[model samples]
Target: MLLNLNKMNDVKKTFDTINKIVADWDPLGVGETIAEDEYAGYIPEIIQVMKNDQSLFEYLSQILANELGRGFDSTDMKHVEGLKSICDKIIRAYMDI
Candidate 1:
């Protein structure tokens, strides 16, 4: 159990470091944050997550629409899935390092 806590802490530190670099989709150009090429690779899988969970999709859509001034159009559903895939993969990949 103690080891698991330590492992989680390491993951959180990694997440923080990555966030400091990416800074919410804006490249800080410093850390090992998710880049365009990396994001592209994960899109398909993330889309599957969003498709399987309606609440997650709605939450993401609302955030984009209200916070980012990004409105969903005909392509948004597909785009959301892609983005979700990319982000999920990034999160999973970063959890270890």
Candidate 2:
């Protein structure tokens, strides 16, 4: 449809503008390419965390505890406080902070 094409073109232009801006404005060139081992090591934990119904931090902590041979109760207040720290770390890592 003509309307669909126009909408697509508008979106394409917007994306082009954004790309140009980012190309001009990157402050950090970027970090080291993530190593395969690093990613592989986190795979199981990331998957378990994704599968959890609890908050992401609590979920990640639980996964870590399991990996470290410790029993952690996600519902406990101490773990919940730990979850807050985990949350900060996660958000910071993703630049969502």
Candidate 3:
């Protein structure tokens, strides 16, 4: 049971770290204009994609574009592109756990 507890703790830690990363990105500008947790709803999905070793960039881009209620364009692409680093950060963080 100790091992299971440790795994649970690691998962919680990863979730918290990724949550912060997503909030920092503030895809909806909510951190500055609205609330900090505005993007909290998307974190679980992001984590799932990350854990599954899926295409984080593509998944994030789609989520961002959908939330912004617009078609994926150059500007939007560029904005989301900035978030690509978070993917690496998350991977490193997860590995460390």
Candidate 4:
């Protein structure tokens, strides 16, 4: 139906926005030199957190610690806070749709 198609389009839009957020966050400092999908691997996990109403910051912290072999320290407080805000922003964006 047309309604379903419209909803799917909205979902895709949200996904694309989230994808850019992850890449723009650029935790690896690759900047625009990397492909747009460079952070695509994290998209599903971010979506999962949004769907489950879970804490993205916690999930991201786990990923950084286990997958990246790096963890935020006191000196990285700003980056940590930015991640937290991104979590809130994602949830709001998804719910608003």
Candidate 5:
């Protein structure tokens, strides 16, 4: 359906944005050691997208599952939880909008 396609496209765009942010922060990609300060700068941008796009949570959840499937460790899980917490805070802030 066209609606489903649009949702998928939105999710893909969000994922691409996340990938670009991570790549920009650490040119060597996710496995690289990025400075916490540098990485923190992009969290707002990601949270904005999640606040704007309802499909993003679903996409993010799937990505988290894939990462867990690949044997991601506790640190990765904590990072994911932190992101979800931020998303939750943003959602609550704008729930009436």
Candidate 6:
């Protein structure tokens, strides 16, 4: 019972981290809106990855980083790196779960 509770807590924390990353990347919000349709596709994919299997988390993270990088100015390495950092955090949190 205690172990189950701890696992649940970990899942919740992981979800919260994922949510933060998604919100940060929301096209309608502060995030860039370059590839609006493509960006829309990512949320569902993220949720699917969250459900289907954990082994694919790294792939999802890389795809997200690539999509985010494409949305920003090509010369903006700082912004691209920041987005990649967010992806890294999401991947780390997912792994923790």
Best by lDDT: 4
**Candidate number of the best TM-score:** 4
Q: Give the per-residue lDDT of model 6 (tens digit) for 1-97.
A: 9999998897567655566666656634555444344354455456556543343445454664565443444357875566556556656667766
Query: Which segments of candidate 1 are over 4 A away from where they belong?
Result: 1-14, 17-24, 27-57, 74-78, 94-97
Model 2 Cα lDDT, one tens digit per residue, 1-97: 9999998886555444333332332212332342322224443444335333355556556545765444567579986675565555443433321
Worst 10 residues of 6 by lDDT: 52-61
**Candidate 6 clash figure, as a count:** 0
Between prediction 1 and prediction 5, which has the larger TM-score?
A: 1
Q: 93 in model 6: Cα distance from truth in Å?
A: 4.0
Higher-ranked by lDDT: 2 or 6: 6
For residues 1-97, what per-residue lDDT tens digits would candidate 3 score against the true structure?
A: 9999999998778777777766776656666445346766777777777754347767776875786664456466666556566677767766776
- Rank by TM-score, highest first: 4, 3, 6, 1, 2, 5
In model 1, state the lDDT of residue 61: 55
Q: Residue 36 deviation, candidate 1, in Å?
A: 15
**TM-score to native of every candidate shown:** 0.39, 0.37, 0.71, 0.74, 0.31, 0.42
Pairs in steric clash, model 5: none
- lDDT score of model 5? 0.49
Q: On a 0 to 1 TM-score scale, where does candidate 4 land against the true structure?
A: 0.74
> Clashing pairs in model 6?
none
Residue 59 lDDT (model 6): 44
Candidate 2: C-alpha RMSD to true structure equals: 11.1
Q: Model 1 over residues 19-91: C-alpha lDDT tens digits?
A: 4433445422323444534333323433334434454456445545665566655376787675565456445
RMSD of each: 8.5, 11.1, 3.2, 2.8, 10.1, 7.2
Worst 10 residues of 1 by lDDT: 38-47
Which sequence of candidate numbers ranks them by lDDT, best first? 4, 3, 6, 1, 5, 2
